[model samples]
Target: MTGSREALPDVDGSGLTLGDRAAIALTEYRNGNHQALGELVREATPLLWHTVRAQGVEHDAAEDVVQSTWVALVRHAETIAEPKAVLKWLLVTAKRAAWEAVRKHRDDEKRRTELPDDSPEHPTSLPAKDPLPDAQVLSDERDRILWSSLQQLPRRCQELLRLVSLADRPDYRYISAAIGMPMGSIGSTRGRCLAKLRTILDEQGDFSWT
Candidate 1:
């Protein structure tokens, strides 16, 4: 774990880079669907891992940096001017976070020497850590509007909707895994979910598609 190593995802395997899929994923995420993010992370975590570790961050700390960078992306996706440049943005952010981690770890070591074991410990001296991945919040106006529409769907429909929308391709097997739907039912469930979503949008006047 201490050694630096790169784990690059095979673009040919997915037929596209994580950044290449960012536009689609962002649209799903803005609608408050986290399944899109799971897809993004699967495609991009390797690149992010390499970037963070390239900064001399140890494996464990680098892992944390990579996670935080993704969390930041979720939080800031709506504001990023170029969605196509998602990978570049993530690498840059991870590098910065890596540097901060290295500096703080070094400083923490130095300060530990200043305080003898008998000295009263001051928790404030420790650097603040980024929130755990699940604790991070993703939001924006578009997210709010989309979420309002999604909320109207039945729970089963919401699950199907999120799975179908975020997947790069319609894989019934995957839907079976994601939502425990039998193969025979996946197609109908997806169709119904989409129809329900459209109906909710129209009824709520969420958006008018020409």
Candidate 2:
């Protein structure tokens, strides 16, 4: 069921900008409004999903890590004083949860194999196959170059740009939450990420995509 906070009026067509609405939601949660927290989670899931995946966690495992992070947020809600800080808390918490899960998986495998802890199985690596469409090798190379350019961004910038690129909400609240920035900052962050990507491509001399 959607939370009571879901009934909150959408601040913009984007379904509520992260600033006022998120701040209110956190305040509601702090005042013992649990449903408000649920609404916040629903609105924020896509950001969390992208955040965990950007850390090299696979889709399924990352999903689990994100959920666990939200659960942790609820448990720690009393301690988090600022609503604006939720996004940052969620991002860092999700990444750490992902790493913790990876570590546990490795330890489990080591115990099963009767090996030293140092011999624990490695986390499954990111898929290495180029995601290029079926095409000539030259086109595939270009695709790889573009993706490599994306990977070169700072971890937070990569997550922000990736989500913003796919944003459907005209108001861009999703983009703001995904990047943990104020609504006013979304436009500038977009420009900065674009500029960084451009510089990377320019440095690599792969202006063919332009």
Candidate 3:
């Protein structure tokens, strides 16, 4: 008992992105801090969850696909060229993974057709198909109108506005990271995007950003 080791103090590792933490933890794992890698996986899951769902993968399959994406991340962590760029890589990877899940669903349907009633293909073939009555449809139509307006901007403007609009991170680091630009440029980009958005709305004849 006299020679027992002392316990370590707990530390909260905040102010970091999941990708940044994952990259650091991955380096730690390579250097022998095995437990840290697990922490990275847990932290990064939510981002992947949102991204996968955003890509139209249903909740359950998106969960599985995201888990597999992390597993793959661990395996490929060493190959990432720039740790600073990890979030974009993760997003792109999640999008690709989500699409892959969708492709698998389609393939499963094709195979089930070949195999008959024993295992009728996965039920995720159709996206959420809840029917909305007239009022609900009009409301949805309004949202679509706004979304379509955003898309009508030039490609750069569209990407920049989407970068700002879709981000939940208020720190701006995440948006800067996603867009591969300096943090200082984000505000200007956002302004230009807003102007373009307003112009699009004004030109629409029936809508106005005001």
74-167: candidate 3 lDDT, tens digit per residue: 6876676655455566766877888888888867866766544435444436567322346655576456666778767775665555545544
Per-residue C-alpha lDDT of model 1 across residues 58-169, encoded as one tens digit per residue: 6678889988998899889777665545555665687789889877876776677654543436533343532222312335444554676776788677655654454445
TM-score of 2: 0.55
Clashing pairs in 2: none
**For residue 23, what is the lDDT in candidate 1?**
48
State the number of backbone clashes in model 2.
Answer: 0
lDDT of 2 by residue, 20-67 (tens): 455567667778777867787887777677666655665677778988
Candidate 2 residues lying further than 4 Å off, grouped into runs, are: 1-16, 106-157, 163-192, 198-210
Q: Against the hidden true structure, what lDDT does model 3 obtain?
A: 0.62
Which sequence of candidate numbers ranks them by TM-score, best first?
2, 3, 1
Quality of model 1 by C-alpha lDDT: 0.62
Report the lDDT of model 1 for residue 47.
57
Model 1 clashes, total count: 0
Instruction: State the lDDT at 65 in candidate 2.
Output: 90
